[model samples]
Target: MAKSLKSPPADLTRISTRNGGTFPLARISKVISGEAQLPGGHGNREMPVWGPFFSRVDADQDLGRMRVDSLARYLRKIQQP
Candidate 1:
């Protein structure tokens, strides 16, 4: 008897929850402008914030399609009341 081949499980992508688990768009801009603040009442100081920086792609760039329902659900989960 031949054994059946098993398929691998689907990959699960996770969102980062650092910095209060929120996307800091304003904070990022402030940091770029040299006016960012530290958390917990710490005095203002220069800190190196490193992350991926991508150039602006065309509006019609087609990497792939995202499920709107899934994205809406995720956004709803993270939204503050």
Candidate 2:
């Protein structure tokens, strides 16, 4: 399909913000492919999101979960006066 000037791209092309996260491209891909979700969250309830946050943890933990609360905590951690 040709590029449409009426709406945004169906698949993410770039990430304008990382929200203190890493690998912007990979994150975008996960969301675009609808593979982003919590360990036991709702099924088939995924939606394209912006400015995602991620955590790097142990092997037994959720090493690559995309969640908004993660972003919330990060924002609070780096809040400015």
- Rate residue 70 of model 2 by lDDT: 57
**Which tens-of-lDDT digit does each residue in 1-81 have in candidate 1?**
123313322111212244455545455444433445544325534343322121123343222112222343454355442
Give the number of the best model, judged by TM-score.
1
TM-score of every candidate relative to the true structure: 0.28, 0.25
lDDT of 2 by residue, 9-53 (tens): 332212233334333444444553345652234544434443232
RMSD, every candidate, angstroms: 14.5, 11.6
Candidate 1 has its poorest 10 consecutive residues by lDDT at 49-58
Q: Which pairs clash (backbone N, Cα, C closer than 3 Å) in model 2? A: none
lDDT of each: 0.35, 0.39
